[model samples]
Target: MRKVMFAMNISIDGCHEHTHFNPGEDLMDYFTGLMQDTGVIVYGRKTYELMVPFWPEVAKNRTGRPCDVAFADAMTRIEKIVLSRTLENADETTRIVRGDPEGLIRELKQQPGEKIAFSSTSLLPRLLEAGLIDELYLIVHPVLVGENKRLFDNFLVPEKLNYRLEYTRLFKSGAMALHYQKSE
Candidate 1:
């Protein structure tokens, strides 16, 4: 079974606005590795709209930094599954999925693949509550944005979610990549 990994770039205070945080080369490289390892990426409607146009442009023009370009290229190569009730169609590389999110995700996990990655935090709470996420890669940045969207905006877990810290990597920018697995 493929692991469901929830990966996100969040602030020290738990803010998760992509525009607010600037991913340095090393951070971008880390994301590139995740993209390369992931067979399919799951995105919510909002994130899909935000990334669909930008990453393809970066992939085509190679206009971004070396790390950005590499990340973009990797992103373009992977399969994308956007779960949205409003979105009807997407690019050839992506599939638009509607209906029960947890049930569909369970089916995806049973499939043979490298990994199924949850790239959108908006979709995390539901999957986390359903106990579908196997691991988490939280890239905690140094700065704190006082007011913004949080990583767990509407999270409501009945029981306390236990996690074991798999490892940690401190970046030069003072940001840290924290890896955790859901404790059984």
Candidate 2:
């Protein structure tokens, strides 16, 4: 079965606002590498809006640093699945999927794919609670956002979920990328 990986960047204090953290070239490069193994990326409407036009535009314009441009290119090329009932349309590389997001994800996992990646904070709790995520990647940045949406504020699992640390990578910007797999 393909792995369902939930990856996100969070602040030291558990804030999940992407803009709160400053990811350097190394971090961007690392994410770009992660994209290489991902066949489909899943996002909630909010994240989709934040990532779409911006990254695709960046890829087309070849803007930002070399690493950023490369990451943008990779992001634009990869297939994206957005789970939103209200979203009406998306770009060519993106598919807007509605009705039972969890069921759709389970079906996607059974299909042939490299990895099903998830990057939406709004959907994290639901995925975790449903035990749909096979792996988790948390890039902890070395900063604190006093007030914002927290990482696990709404996380409520029926039973305690256990995860085994698979690996970790420390970036030059003092950010740490932690990879964890669900303990079988």
Candidate 3:
């Protein structure tokens, strides 16, 4: 079985929404490189919709961020999976998985690959409850939300899960990427 991982960029207060990248930083390329090693990309319907268009177009707009364009090409090469309830047709190329998310992920674990990833905080706790995700790759932004979207937004009891810090890097904006694995 491959290492199932969850990669997400969130604000200090843990908001997974919004487009945030400081000047002189090519965040998309940074993330795309991560995807290059991934055989599959999975996301909540919202994240898929938000990224689908940009990923393709970023390739064409190699105006300044050359690496970003390369990243776009990398994104186009990978398989994309989306978890949605009401989506009828996700782009012709995207795989849409409806019904029980936990069951689907559990099934994915049985497949041949390094791992599967999910990019939704909304879905993270459920994955945790099911004990599916093996690790987490989180990009923690320094900006705080006095009141905004939360990362641990679910009814997850904090004490139930244990985290083993994997790595940390501080960016110029004070943002950082904190990787953690669930200690079983």
Evaluated with TM-score, which candidate comes out highest? 2
Ranking by lDDT: 2, 1, 3
Write the residue-wise lDDT of candidate 2 on 1-184 in tens digits: 8889988899989998877877899999999998999999999999999999999999999889999899998888889999999999999889898978889889989999799998778788898888899999999999888899898998888999999999999999999999999998
Among the numbered candidates, top lDDT falls to 2
Task: Give the per-residue lDDT of model 3 (tens digit) for 76-181.
Answer: 7777888998777776668998878888777777888755667766787888877778888788777776666667777466457778998886766676777888
Better of 2 and 3 by TM-score: 2
TM-score leaderboard ranking: 2, 1, 3
Lowest summed lDDT across 10 adjacent residues in model 3 is found at 20-29
Stretches of candidate 3 off by over 4 Å are: 20-29, 60-64
Task: Compute each candidate's TM-score over C-alphas.
Answer: 0.96, 0.97, 0.87
Predicted candidate 2, C-alpha RMSD: 0.9
Clashing pairs in 1: none
> Which pairs of residues collide in model 3?
2-114
Candidate 1 structure lDDT: 0.89
Candidate 2 Cα errors over 4 Å, as ranges: none
